[model samples]
Target: MKPSLLVLTSLPDDNRERIAASFDILYAPTHEARAKSIAKHGATIRAVLTNGTTGLSASEVDRLPALELVSALGAGYENIATDHARTRGIVLTNGAGANDDCVADHAFALLLAVVRDVPQRDRATRDGIWRDALPLRPSVSGKRLGVIGLGRIGEKVARRAAGFDIDVAYHNRKPRDGVTLRYFDNLRDLARWSDYLVVATPGGAGTHHLIDAHVLEALGPTGFLVNVSRGSVVDTDALAHALKSGAIAGAGLDVYESEPHPPQALLHLNNIVLTPHVAGTSPEANAACVDTFIENATRHFAGEDVLTPI
Candidate 1:
């Protein structure tokens, strides 16, 4: 018999069907259903499939005594009880590189949309307004683009920026190997120097509100900010104030503090572009993520080294 798996995410129908064919899946995409499923079938569950946002908690993990492997369907796993799982000798894996291209594509889409005022211009055109009536926006080409995290997604963003003749620099906890791009030890310095600041860092306590009032100020009146990272990284209030006061030129965000609810403070702002947290949701990316999970689970069950361990 196949090992029983508890799936906590709401997968696409095709992905769900694929997983069902491989494992005895206990689908629980809602909180009440999750609790009930755990209560009824926890002992039989040998693995869990979750994502970064809908993490598996320590308390939940404890109930599943048979769980040996936990897989995050996407790159981030900030909410997962990683330390607790490690202590219990449970294996953890994530879809680290699976969705990088999709996310990078979205990040560039946001950056271009806001910088060029694409959304606003489209609205103006539809409302019988002419190009002469609309205020001019800055050119994105030949500008300095600063990346907050130089990981897989960040590197891809930098690569895209290059196509527009933009110079790239980054601020990571430490510099990555084999990269010639300029590195900034201080995030504020990077912000001050950049024409556009793009955040692609990991989410968690350490990076909570990392881009706050001071960083926004450093980006100054002419700069723009783009966040494809976690919402917690940027303070919503600060960003709103900056946009309202013209402290920064504009912003483009894929993730925000409010999450399922839109950022109330930024809703009325005309200088910002917002998208639901969908930086990595493409058909190709989703397929790659699920494939990565299956590979990790297969390797772990066969006593082989799991790929993309977190």
Candidate 2:
């Protein structure tokens, strides 16, 4: 018999079919469905597939006595009860580098869109507004770019910046080994030094609102901020105020504090660009994510070391 695998995310039909070919899928993408599926099939479920946002909780983990693995289909596992799962001897894995290039691509798209005022320009051009009527936007090239986290995605962002002749520096809890890019132990210092700040850090309490009012002030009137990381890392209220008051020139965010719904405060602002948390999503990325999950789950069931253990 195929191993029972509980799925908690909503996937496209093709992706769903791909996974279902390998396991007996529970297919609970909604909240009520999740609860009902767990209650009814708890004992048979040997693994649970979830993403960063829709995490598996401790109570749910406890209910599934047969669960041997919990896999996050993306790099983030912030909401997953990792510690609790650890205590229960459940293996955890995430899609760490599966979408790194895609995320880096989106980050650059946001950066260029905001810095060049692409959205506003498109609107103005459609309105028959001449080029002279628009205010001058800053050049993205030859600027100091600060990256908040220098993980795989962050490194890719830096690489993209290089194509534009941008200078790159980054901040992490500790400096990454064997990188020639300048490193800052302090985040505020990185913000102060940068013309554009791009956040690629992980979410959770340690990095909650890592970019706040003080950091914004340090970024000052001419700087730009971009967040392709978790929304909690950048305070929406603070960003809204900054954009309104011109504390910073503009911002580009792929993630925000309140998700699924747009950030109400930032909606009316023209100096910001927002994408619906799709930094790591693409047809290619999605396929890679699904493939990574299958590989990890398969290896774990075979008593082999799974790739990308979280």
Candidate 3:
């Protein structure tokens, strides 16, 4: 019989059909359904497919006594109970490079949208307000950009920066080898040097609220901030205060601390642009993510090492 696989996150119909061809699927994309499915089928489940946001918990892992593999369908495995799964010898994998280009493209979209005041201008134009009445926005080209966590997505963001003639620098735990871009050991220093600060770091307890009030202050009154990574990486309260008080000029966010629901604190601000955490989402990206997961899971089932293990 095909291995039983429980799916925790919602997937497109086509993607679900594709996965169904490989395994016997127990589709549970809702909270109530998840509990019901687990209670009913936990003993037979041999694998799980979930996303970072809809993670498998330690307790959930405990109930799935037969689970041998856990796969996150995206680059992030932040919310997965990785240590617990590892202790049980369950192979863990993620689609790390699957959506990098899509995310990088969205990052630049946010940057351009905020810096050029596109949304606001579009609205003003619709209301018959001309360019002369609106406040001037800064040019995005030739500005200095500071990237946090120079991983696959960050590297793609930097590569896109080259087309705009933007000078790029990065801050990581340490300098990355073969990366000739300027590295800042300190995040605050990087913020001070950059006209634009793009956060692309991972989410977890270690990186929670990494971008707080102090970093926003260092970004200064003329600087713009963009976050394409996890919402937990930037503090929502601090970001709202910064935008309202002119600590930073403006911001564009694809993720926020309060997800599914709009950020209450930033809703009243006109200097910010928000997207519902869709930086890594696109038809092409979704296909790539699914393909990566299938390849990894197939390899794991075949007694081979899974690609992109966390």
Model 1 C-alpha lDDT versus the unseen true structure:
0.95
Q: Write the per-residue lDDT of candidate 3 for residues 52-71, one digit (tens) a residue.
A: 88899999999999999999
Model 3, residue 85: what's the lDDT? 97
User: Tens digit of lDDT per residue, candidate 1, span 1-310?
Assistant: 9989999988899998888778999889999999999999998999999988889999999999998999999999999999999989999999999999999999999999999999889998899999888778889999999999999999999999999999999999999899999999999999999999999999989999999999999999999999998999999999999999999999999999988799999999888999999999999999999999999998998999998999
TM-score of each: 0.99, 0.99, 0.99
Q: Ten consecutive residues with minimal summed lDDT in candidate 1? A: 131-140
Model 3 TM-score on a 0 to 1 scale: 0.99
- After superposition, the stretches of candidate 2 with alpha carbons farther than 4 Å from their true spots are none
Model 2 lDDT per residue over 158-267, tens place: 99999999999999999899999999998889999999999999998899999999999899899999999899999889889999999999999999888888999999
Query: Where in model 3 is the C-alpha error above 4 Å?
Result: none
lDDT of 2: 0.94
Task: For candidate 3, list the clashing residue pairs, or say none.
Answer: none
